[model samples]
Target: MRFDQQFLEDIRNRVSLSDVVGRRVTWDRRKSQPGKGDFWACCPFHSEKSPSFHVDERRNRYKCFGCGESGDHFKFLMETEGLSFPEAVEELASSAGISLPAPDPQAAFKAAKRNSLTDICEMAVRYFQQVLQSPAGRSAQEYVQRRGLSAETLSEFQFGFAPPGRDNLKTALLAKDVTEAELVEVGLLIKPEDGRPSYDRFRNRLMIPIHDERGRAVAFGGRTMDPDGQPKYLNSPETPIFHKGTMLFNVHRARKPAFDAGQAIVVEGYMDAIALSQVGIKGTVASLGTAFTEDQILRLWKFSDEPVICFDGDVAGISAAHRAVDRILPALTSGKSFQFAFLPDGQDPDDVINAGGVSAMYAEIERALPLSEVVWQRETSQARIDTPERKAALEKAVEDLVGTIKDERIQKRYRMDLRLKLSNLFYEESRRNRGPAQKGGGGGGWRNNKQGGDEDRASTARMEAPDTPAYGVERSFCTMCLMFPELFERHFERISQLTYSNELHSMFMTALVRIATDLAEGTVTQIYNKLDERFYKILQEAIVSSRPDEDSSKASTLQRWDTLTNRLQILKEDPPEDFVEHLFLNYADMLELRMLEMELEHETRAMEENLTEESWSRFQALKQDLTRRREDCLRDEQELAERGTKMKLNKAAMRG
Candidate 1:
């Protein structure tokens, strides 16, 4: 009976590959490759010592390198378990919870036949598990204990033992009404090609039942307790329901936890996955023996937007991680990404736990780099950028890699960020080539005047400072004094006399004067500590907006503070080099005069409405104060104008 393509795909998706292969193969964690998501076990077919068999649960396929055997679940069953093609499909369909097509007689017959085979496999599992608890299974139990497996974990993973002796399983299952022919067909009993009588296939081995995604036992993985055992570990042959590549070790149990955590972690082996789970990091899985494939990534993304691929810190592990990164990029989509975590040298997840407990393993995982960071580091750090050509090539390499991102918005952002980094790198290089003259200095705008060689330093400083009695001038002075408190030493008395209309400005200026007076060698930190929290935030904002050119240089603490203060002071005042100090004084007086004017106007308005004696007296006093302040401000401005003209005349006479 032909099945619909959609139905077949649905069944395949429902039954995970790990489940099917796990039932047949005990994961030999020692043989697993780190970061590749490859699970390994001894070849179940024509096995000698050592494991050449790999199961890639993510790909839903199994392959034995030793025998060159590879296939999906259906192929495995047909070849190893003596099931026909129809029987294999029926077995999978049933396990996948897929109902066979209605009105199909052959489908029903095959389904029934497959159900019987599955029952035989289940009965075999029970027999093996029971034997492991018997006196004959003592060695297997000891081995499990030595490996540090808890009894609960052993039971949960269905640890068992096959007693030594040819007919052990045969005699046990046959008593349960299982036929010899059925046992032979399921590969539980061996029938030699030369026509020898069938006997038990596994003997004197610790057995682990591999369960499908549905937790149905379909195959067995056996580990020999004997030190001199020919094959240290063995797995059940590919049966109608098991394939290695399409599965991940422990994924059945880890999937929900991974989904909950918003991430899934891919480790190298089953033991690593299990150990992590034991430590409370439950969303861990091992790739069956192969490099991470696109299918595996897709499956991981179902559980998490970003799955961390953790590998050993060795050469092979790094290579595998990079390979996985490269593979994931082409298929990258919006909101989907991968992180790479490399374990320390000579350490696996198990070693990490043994050394520093589970937290150590978590520490390693926490250091995982996002996909873009890894790619950027890989490209830029490895490139030679001594020459212009090489630097250009490095930039091109970054752009080329970023261009692979299909999402236009993401691609555009990458381009922007990458370009900025490139620009900064080159800009720094140019500055280094130019050397010390690039550093900012000279009081007021004098340094820029000299460096720029535009107008004379004196003339530029005069041209730059503005004489306007502007609002916020007090804030400018206070911010400057806070930044470069040394400047406050000479002007402290004048600063103390200043009053601010803005409450926040008043508090900030007061705090600055107090801090500068208390600390002999005034430090920004000292002033910062004395400030109102909001004023401290204002100070930081002032610093950030102070000097753009001086920001890049690595300045000493005092120098940085001074530069910040000086830049802001220059921004507030437009005066010749000698007149900068006078300008600051004038700026403070103008602020005070403006406040007096505003107070006078308010008092006058109240007097006009109420005509009360108290209001009239207050209005009269305010008017008197405003008149005195305006007169004093005009006198100061006139004095500043005359002083500037005298300085210009002196400069001209010196030039002549």
Candidate 2:
């Protein structure tokens, strides 16, 4: 079912875009603008030099100039991570605590088919768990014992056993009134040409239930006890409920601990994960015996920035690590890092912890090699450093590594380090270029004409670009305003007088007008009541510098009032769009101020004489007219806002 726009807007309101994306990308608060509370960061969707990615917290929208990507939270997830419509909806719903409505009649058939299949798989998991305790499960139990796994660990991992007979699961499922077609749909039973339905998967094997992050059993991986078994391992076929590429073994159980500890340990096999957990290393998970995928790495990063990869100290393990590094390098950022921990020869985490203690295993993990060094060593070993070919290869590798680093400061530092290393290597090559025969009498220094020429060209090319300040002047001004609102108040009149076409300037003027109207209404609370939540938050930050105390002096109050009045004057000089409504609101605000002043004057006049009937009648008529005008202005403002909403809808439709 498609979500309603209002419902989606509600979800956006609940979920902070900055908080959601900031976990993946490092974001720096941009200078605060008057009406806009926005942040900037390098776009994760594309590579760029300057941060052109803008996040509008108030509007709940994000736009990237480099990639031309713009969207709300759900669309961002779909585009950024390549998730399907329903998958994105499911994820956002789970995050936002929203429950999607059931599918319509058209979708009911497909939904029912999926539900039936999922029920079968869940039933299968339960059947296997129960069978593991039966007489038929003795061999499976013995296999677990041989592997040094305890009953508690087996239960925690949800290890199960399928009986040897082909019809065993079928018979059990049939006894529960489950149909043949339903079992076939779940990949448990296969349909033969003879029109008979029979089990074709997992016979006489130990079943390991594969769970999603929600702890739901979606599929299984079965291992055979018989050495002569046709297949060593059998995995569940793809169904609506499971996708192997997206699933990480034991993640359902490991996520909480990993998040709590601020790191996750990724292993190669399910056994390695189980072994580590049994020995008190609970934050471990394994890919489903496949290559490390970008999607899997993103999922891992969602829980923590640092994930330690533990591989067996073997040729296959080393090869896997190299592949992982190549796949994951482009996804890394400055704040995010990875490490590798290689076990001893012919050993795994299970063996290490069993032979030694958990502390000993922890020490090995603590000494894990950083991801950068691992990448460098692997690249360097593939070629000879003394040759020109090797030097070129090194330069390319360094460039690749530096390019992948998202943070500008970190990338620059890495580039400098790489240049130094290359320079040293080149110096050694230059020394070797000169023959040893001329060294004793008069040393012939090696001249690298090609290298010197290339360096000169590179330096000349670099001089073409002008240096720009990291933070622009406008941004600096906005940040200063946010940090010290009182200072902003002091210079408010000057700020209001300035005019500009930029978004920052427009937003600031909007905020200043709103603040002026609020101050004229007497109390800050009255001003907030008239404004939307988004504008209110901006005003709160713009005005409240330090807390007001009961002992605040009259002079301090007058100074604050004067500062605010000046800021309002400057903002009014060059008003933003909707200046007409702002003027109307300001007029009504003046009426309220006048009424207060007149009421005080009338109180003082009461001592001179009882007010005459004519004077009282005139006073009441004036008050009524003022009230009527104020209400008329309020009605006009609401009508204008409604028109603006309609205009936005029309614009969206036209674009679509």
In terms of TM-score, the best-performing candidate is 2
RMSD of each: 24.9, 22.4
- On residues 230-310, what C-alpha lDDT tens digit does candidate 2 reach at each position? 677787777777787888888878876776566689998887888889977888998887788888887887556668999
Question: Candidate 2: where is the Cα deviation over 4 Å?
Answer: 8-99, 106-110, 190-198, 393-419, 423-656
**Model 2 residue 478 CA deviation in Å:** 35
**lDDT: which candidate is best?**
1
- lDDT tens digits by residue: candidate 1, 1-656: 77777876776678865566666566788877535657888755433346777878667678988667787777765544334466668899999888876747887787677778879989988888898899988998888777667877777777788999989899888899999988877668887889888888789998776665556676676767778986765766656665665566676677667765666999976666767877778888887556777777776776776889998978888777777777787677655789888788788887898889876887677667667656655665455555777767776777778777777655644554444334334433443356665421121221122343221111212211233445346556665564333355556787787777666667867765665445334322323434454453344434333333321232232232213344443442223323555556677778777767777888877777778988888888888887888888789778767766766666456334
RMSD of 2: 22.4
Compute the lDDT of residue 199 as modeled in candidate 2: 64
Q: Which ten residues in a row have the lowest lDDT in candidate 1?
A: 455-464
Model 2 pairs in collision: 492-567, 493-566, 493-567, 496-570, 496-571, 497-570
Give TM-scores for every candidate, taking all chains together and pairing residue i with residue i.
0.46, 0.53
